[model samples]
Target: MKGEFMSLILTTILHFAATNIDDIFLLLTWFLQRDSKLKSSHIIFGQYLGFIALVILSVIGALGALIIPQEWIG
Candidate 1:
């Protein structure tokens, strides 16, 4: 996914990081910490990414939660 920085720039910045999830979080933390130095657009971009991530996670969790046996779901 493209970050506030371009996809190429984001990929390069995370190249040495571990897994994709770790790299994404690392970069996000770095950006949030530098919010004062970043432009409004970038800040918004970061927030959007964070929100989307949360939404996706919530959806996945909801799906998993539905897998519970009906007998135990009472």
Candidate 2:
């Protein structure tokens, strides 16, 4: 039980870190740009929307994979 819990925790951490790795650079660039008119709130809102879209697309792809046959895939 403890092993499974630890694995789950590690997987969650790694998944989140991997997905947001690009966001770190993007947010930094947005903040560093001189002519940019975007506020921090706008950046945060855009990030949220983007993440939600990613999650939705992932779910749809996963479901499609499950529904399709292995023979048809290749």
Candidate 3:
């Protein structure tokens, strides 16, 4: 039951982040605008680059978890 509860929480977190995709893009656009480079292409590029970076970080995190000791949780 505890495992199931954790799964539900993880799913909810994923859904919340998926819903915020546009907000992320907009935030990137704002930052670009600060430098007068918020053109459509630049904003799109920023969004793609941010997404790739996030994917890399997630992969690293998952790999790190496999190597890290789980004694704390146990």
My TM-score estimates for the predictions, one after another, are: 0.43, 0.70, 0.56
Best by TM-score: 2
lDDT of each: 0.72, 0.88, 0.81
For model 3, which pairs clash? none
lDDT of 1: 0.72
Candidate 2's error at 44, in angstroms? Answer: 1.0
lDDT of 1 at 35: 53
- Please report how far candidate 3 places residue 59 from its true position, in Å: 0.6
Better of 1 and 3 by lDDT: 3
Clashes per model (N, Cα, C within 3 A): 0, 0, 0
What is the alpha-carbon RMSD of candidate 3 to the true structure?
A: 5.2
Over the stretch 1-74, how does candidate 3's per-residue lDDT look in tens digits?
99999999999999989988888787765776665545676766877898789889989988888888988535
Q: How well does candidate 1 match the true structure in TM-score terms?
A: 0.43
Instruction: Tell me how far the alpha carbon of residue 37 in candidate 2 is from the true structure, in angstroms, after superposition.
Output: 3.1
Better of 2 and 3 by TM-score: 2
Error of 3 at 15 (Å): 1.1
